[model samples]
Target: MNDDRATSTRSETPEAILHGGDLHAVSGRYPDAPQPWIDLSTGINAVPYPVPEIPPSAWQRLPAKSEERILLTAAAARYRVASRDTIVAAPGTQALLQSLPRLRPRSTVAVLAPTYEEHALCWRRCGHQVHLVDDADALAHADIAVVVNPNNPTGRLLPRDVLVRLAAAQRRRDGLLIVDEAFVDLYPANASLAADLPPATIVLRSFGKVYGLAGVRLGFAISSADIATRLRGELGPWAVSGPALAVGTAALADDAWLAQTGARLARDGQRIEALLENAGCAVIGITPLFRLIASPIAAGIADRLACHGIHVRRFPAQPTWLRFGLPSHEGDWERLAQALGSSS
Candidate 1:
């Protein structure tokens, strides 16, 4: 079966969201399978961090500069970033991603292929020349190099030293390096490039993925102080809501929650790998929050899962591959196992 997929801006049409998490459309197709759908399409933590109570004033007033400061400060501390001047907060990583093309003039951009398609999509839509490279080592020739560390779908993480060298080389030629570390925090100490950020390097981190608060709509862009200043101005003031700022601050500062949740995700990821393998699916790339598997009948398997009111991500680029997120509960896990057992 043809497995090509696409993403949308909220899936205005029923057929728009081909990428993942389109339960609204799934429900229409499988009305008889189940009541609630078990969506394992994205790498978001299934057991999300417990959201703390927000002050009523947070909802009553506009997000002040002081409130933003608290959120950024908390993010810096949590991420172990040394310089606050180099970090710029936004409504979400997606907002910064699309705006990045606007900040620079049309130029040649080399995106590591088969990662997150949105990187290339946003650049191409903004009139930039985009070239798809095979790996991080292929960044040598591009004017702007985009690396999705712990890459989406494949979970192929580029080495820190290699990234540092690439950034230095790119900067020498007046070029730039953009790293999407959206899924890097699960292995933060070993995987993150935030601590020793090089000049001309722009790193994007997500508050929603690890914290399981995608709706909170908060993220950060890390770069040189000048670039951060420029992005801050371009994004304008009050880019994030007061409720988002308050909630993000509490979530970022919860050390106990972070540690406990991280451990739980790691443990759960292993269970998923074993389960998938036992079901005859080859567990290929295992990330802390998700797993990418290979099945001869991946498209059919995904369709079968949908019939059971379970949704998984399928990639046409690699016809045999499917991505699955952690199932949140015992019933959901049992449902998934039964679905897999019955998969074509």
Candidate 2:
């Protein structure tokens, strides 16, 4: 699509899009639904890492520079990035996403779509001409290109080499490439773009998804030193809280917990897919944290699940599709199965 046409189509003020994990909103819609809704909407890990005890000072005092450095160091090691200086911590990846567009002049932005809507919304809010494109090749045509690796909902994973080539193209034109690796934690280390980052490329990682600590709101941006410095300046000092620093530092270093959780999530992922298939929904995507399925009655099924106090994600743009995050416990699994059987 042409930039002028795309720019004209976007509203001057973008509307906020619906996101998962808002139990209150769902409850309000389905007031008669059972108590304690099972929220299988976001791709966050069902089993969260055990939070380590925080020092009293973490709450008592403002975050110290040294504490932030420690967290960054741990994140750097975990992401396999060589230098901590190339990383910048934020309150969450959402914060970084909002700020990134302001870093550059208003220009053409291409987002790989039917994925997270926030990327397009954020860029458009910053006065960029944003277009949604399904083709990775179309990304080269934009001044800034945004891709979600192991993409949300669809679980689409672009090869590292393909992204590298796109990044290189953007670099040659003094453009930028933004890769959101929010769901890549469960994939092999080599699947990430954080390691061996290309020039003019920024990688956004969400600590919340893998660790299941979305409330703590910790995330990072991996980029060239200059870009990292620029992002740091934009976020200002102590952008991350003291408790978040403490929790993130401890959690990122726990290699054993990561391995164990990855295995469990993998098994649960398969189980959910099987359940959906048996319920007559075609499973289309497989990421360790969630599954995407298609059924002609997807909206009806979502409403049925909501009535049963089980909330799964449904897309307005694609009424045939639904996304299911892993259920945390046996009861949740059983509840979901029964709901699906009835919905079918």
Candidate 3:
């Protein structure tokens, strides 16, 4: 028998897996454009919190030694934690996450998959034994468990009680639990797990997504003082900047803006959801800025929308899935409906 004939007929692995929201790459392929494009790939707040009137001092002064620490303390109070007990400000959650595995070296870590790739990447880079699973049930026995609450890309959330239970179970095993609440500010009532964190639990929140300040690189981790101290040590001193310190504090201190923004996003998200579902697309989850849907010809749809000056996120291999952002202007939704209607 010939070796070739005895072997399998085909063998190959593709060079790339298509990710959503690569607009700059797409635009590179198609140069002719009639109008400015709308970007829905990132789940950033389109209606950002209005930056407060900052005095000249905010910009001129080298961040006061106490400013960021004060802001972290005040922000922690909003989450109902004692001052300095539950907060550690970093440039952004990404930096802190990259540093976390080192803090818990040798711990058996479990990450929720079909989620943010960064979480797993960071853990693996740190040399932790990492396992990725879809279900929260599989995390109970791990030495450390990490999840993105209202997970990115999917917008799916594990209920607060379930998270509480998972954290409690991890604590029982002398393990740690970490929740990435980057999108939870978009849904407040359903987001109490952070406020009721277990002793071994740590919750990370991003000011970027909610405040539309991604450029500023501000975020924080909430935990008990001991855990906070550990994370602080891991991230090191002056991890955040002065301008970020001022803005983050001002944003949290504004309750009026929080309520108004949350309400507006809820209404807008519902409208977007209904429009997408009506266009024969299945909406998996909803977020203030964007929502995921199943598109039979997702890549084509994204490309077509691009031709029409409308940019949306498409996961190419999974041609049946895409995500779209909500436009605050009522007219943009009408345009989206027409574009999707024509494509579908």
**Which candidate gets the maximum TM-score versus the true structure?**
2
Which digits, one per residue and each the tens of the lDDT, describe model 1 over residues 100-154?
Answer: 9888876778999778888887876666777789967778688889999989978
* Candidate 2 global lDDT: 0.90
Alpha-carbon deviation at 47 in model 3, angstroms: 1.2
lDDT winner, 1 or 2: 2
Model 1: per-residue Cα lDDT at residue 199: 78
| TM-scores for the candidates | 0.93, 0.96, 0.88
- Per lDDT, the best of the predicted structures is 2
List runs of model 1 lying over 4 Å from the truth: 1-17, 342-344
What value of lDDT does candidate 1 attain over all alpha carbons? 0.84
lDDT of 3 by residue, 86-130 (tens): 688889988888877777746567888677767766666555666
- Model 1 scores worst on lDDT over the 10 consecutive residues at 1-10
Task: Give the distance in Å from residue 132's predicted Cα in candidate 2 to where it truly belongs.
Answer: 0.8
lDDT of each residue in 1-344, candidate 2, tens digit only: 45665466467535878888888988899999987899999888878989999999999989999999999999999999999999999999999999998899878899998789999998887678888999999999999999999899898999999999999999999999999999999788889989889888999999999899999998999999988999999999989999999999999999999999998987888788788888889999878888899899999999999999998888888889989999999888888989988321
Q: What is the C-alpha RMSD of each candidate to the true structure, in Å?
A: 5.3, 2.3, 6.2
lDDT preference between candidates 2 and 3, better one: 2
Question: Can you give the lDDT of residue 284 in candidate 1?
Answer: 84
Per-residue error (Å), model 1, residue 195: 0.9
- The lDDT-based order of candidates, best leading, equals 2, 1, 3
